[model samples]
Target: MESDSAYRSRVRSWLDDNLSGRFAHLRGLGGPGREHEAFGERIEWERHLAAAGFTCVGWPPEHGGQGATLQQQVIFYEEYARAGAPATVSHMGQELLGPTLIEFGTPAQQKRFLPGIKNVTELWCQGYSEPGAGSDLASVATTAVRDGDEWVITGQKVWTSLAHVADWCFVIARTEPGSKRHRGLSYLLVPMKQPGVEVRPIKQLTGTSEFNEVFFDGARTAADCIVGEPGEGWRVAMGTLAFERGIATLGKQIGFRRELDAVIGEAKATGAYDDAAVRSAIARACVRLDVMRAYALRSLGNADAGTAAASKLLWSNWHRDLGDLAMMVRGASGLTVGEGYDLDDWQRLYLFTRADTIYGGSNEVQRNVIAERVLQLPREVRQ
Candidate 1:
């Protein structure tokens, strides 16, 4: 086996060669249609990553990974960001469900699903948020009833990112109706191509159907489809959410820093850097960007040590700060869409950042977690 440094260098060299030329056509600011095409191309690019053994670098070699160390995984991501590779399409799977399955899945489940997910052959969407649930995932109203060899599922999941193109969903449903809210939940792997599953696009402020409303009416999965124990869905879901909020956030922060660098370069070229106020603003943005990067690195370290909570208080705050600063720097141009002389990418990012506080648990909820769990503060009283 190659040494870790040798492995990382080899992977870095390969990515530098393979991904550098493919993203030139995708460089400009984009509207919804362009975003769609970019995502499709990204999916193809993820397949190439899988073929090159970079997609699941931390997984064992038997599962189509390179069996790399956690440090190697970090190095790969850093190098990929440095190389300006197009974003991968298997994030929801690779970051969320794949880790969950590896931890909670049976050997048979692992054998059946891991390879497909690793290669992007089966795209997966998260089905935790619903019209009523939102940040309170424990309140999800989706129902799944066991029927001998099958489970009959019915519910509506909103804010399902990429549900239209997803091949499967890791759905959270109420399996025990009258039990405690979190206690009765069960996680099911529901196939989207089944007869009773419907995916309706939800157009965003950017006029893109990047997310969707997924409805499951009498949809069925095998009884064995329950990940982990039947009533243990809450724990499994929390595990997945931890990955969502931690390692995935690290990946995003690294990528966003590149954009922040570009914004700084643009400000300098336009002479905005000379204005005292603009200079101060840019400095503040850079400071917050650095903080975000540091927090992400800390979270990755915690994740590798297996101690990350379902969410972190500092992570959300820094993320919001970074987004707000980028938009503020872009000024009026931040409100426009599509390719323009101005920072239209900043505008798109600004719009999307509104959801950051809400998704992965609202910032309010995260603050509460920190106060009660981390600082040992008194819990707030509410009716």
Candidate 2:
């Protein structure tokens, strides 16, 4: 086993050597609301990372990954973020779906999908959120019915991140009629680029469309594409959620740290550091971020639902608050955009973080999960 320092050194060295030349300009180009920046170039850069065996480092060696230990995976992500490597275009596949497939997918399914993810040959999007189902995934209304060897799907998935560019979608749809809430759902791997599917971009406050509304009039996939037994998808879907909030979060925190540092730099540049309140806010952001780091490191690999929910609450509020501070630092100047409505990093950061508490899981929902599941309090009433 490589020592942690050695692993970190190796990752840093690799990033230093590779993230130059044509890719030199791409550092810190894509993330959050800025997904429109140099996107095609970022895809090329990701393929370069993939070709060098740096992608999907956590999966076992059998699954086309380096089979890196959890600590090493953290080191890689930290180094990657620290290096300002562009935000990956294949996160849905490399981070969420790949691990889910490894855990619950059939051997055949793993064989069919893992390589594409590792190599960045195929991009994926999550089809779990719907017009009505966002965080309440159990209320998914999209339906899939078996037709001979194929499953015909019909429904709409809204706020689907990267759906316009995805070649496949891991969907949670109502597979059994009369099924309610969490029961009778199936996790199906459906392909995009078919006549049955239409992707319409939903404009965001950032003036970008990183997510989309996908209409599945009659999309079809092989019946064998289901991840688990029919009507047992709730379990498999939860497994994917577990993966969704895993070791990769530490890397995300590293990105948060970078964003925070940028905000601090902006404060100094704009003379906001002169204000006692602004200085205190900045200090509080730094201290809270450190606390978040400590909590994440402590909770690594634990997967307690309460801990996960708490972590989400901490980071989401912190990021949104950072956005608020960014605008505060700029004062009235942050309100205006360039002639083309182009926003600088600070403005973009401020606008984008407004949704931080809303997406993934809302702050309200996280509090509810903590109240009922963590505190063992009475559950909130629902209609």
Candidate 3:
């Protein structure tokens, strides 16, 4: 095995060499509020990453990945983020859906989907959130029914990131009639470009449309598209959610570190660092970031819904607060957009992080998960 330092050096060298010329513009684009920065260019940049064997570093080698060790994966992500690489366009497909497919999908399903993901030939979007179901995921109302060789689906999904650009969507649908809550759900892989599917961009406070409202009216997927058993989709869906909190979070922290450094610089330049309270808030952010890293690293093993919930809760609050601090350090200027809707990075961060606590798992839902699962407390009695 290569030494971790050497591996990180190799990744740095690769990025330094490749992220120039035509791709220089993509260096810091397509992250959380900035997904609209460069549309076509980032897709090409993703394919460029895939061509250089930099895409799926953690999956087993048999499934078109490097089969990297956990430490190696962590190192790669750290180096990638440290290099200021753009937020990945293929993150959902490579990190979440691809791994879930390998774990629960049939050999044929893996063969059909994994290669496309590995090469960035086919992009993916998640279909787990719906109009009536967000964090209460078990309350999925999207319905799919048998149609000989295919499952015809009809439902409305909101807050679906990149649904307009994705080629396929892995969906959680009600497969059995009247089976309430967590039961009767199946995880199905549905195509997104078909006639029955309609995608409308939902503008966010950042004045971007990274999230979409996707409507499936008689949308279809093969009968064999189900990841696990027909009615066991909740299990499969939850597994994919766990993957969301996996090794990539280590890299995410590296981005957080960069943002922190920038904020510290702002404090120093604006004389906010002279204020005792601002200094203390900066110190607190440093400590919380370290704690987040420790939690994420320890979370690599034994990832269940409870563990995933904890990780999400920890990072969500920290990041959202960091955004709040960004505004505080910048004083009054951070509130205004530059010339119409063009926002500076701090302005974008401030607006975007407002939804951070609400998107992945709402603060209320995260609290509920932690209360019921990790703490083993009494469940909330619903009226």
- Rank by lDDT (best first): 2, 3, 1
Pairs that clash in candidate 1: none
Question: By TM-score, is 1 or 2 better?
Answer: 2
Roughly what TM-score does model 1 have, to 2 decimal places? 0.89
Every model's TM-score: 0.89, 0.98, 0.97
Best by lDDT: 2
| Candidate 3 lDDT over residue span 296-339, tens digit each | 88878768768788888888888998999999998888866778
| The candidate that achieves the highest TM-score relative to the unseen native structure | 2
Q: Write the per-residue lDDT of candidate 2 for residues 53-99, one digit (tens) a residue.
A: 89999999889898898899889988998898999999999989999
What is the Cα-based lDDT of residue 87 in candidate 3?
87
Residue 129 of model 1 has an lDDT of 94
Q: On a 0 to 1 TM-score scale, where does candidate 3 land against the true structure?
A: 0.97
The stretch of ten residues in a row with the least summed lDDT in candidate 1 is: 26-35
Candidate 1 segments exceeding 4 Å error: 20-35, 301-316, 333-343
- Candidate 2 error regions (>4 Å): none
Query: Which lDDT tens digits does candidate 1 get at residues 226-273?
Result: 898888999999888776765455555566677677767877777667
User: Scored by Cα lDDT, where does model 2 land?
Assistant: 0.90
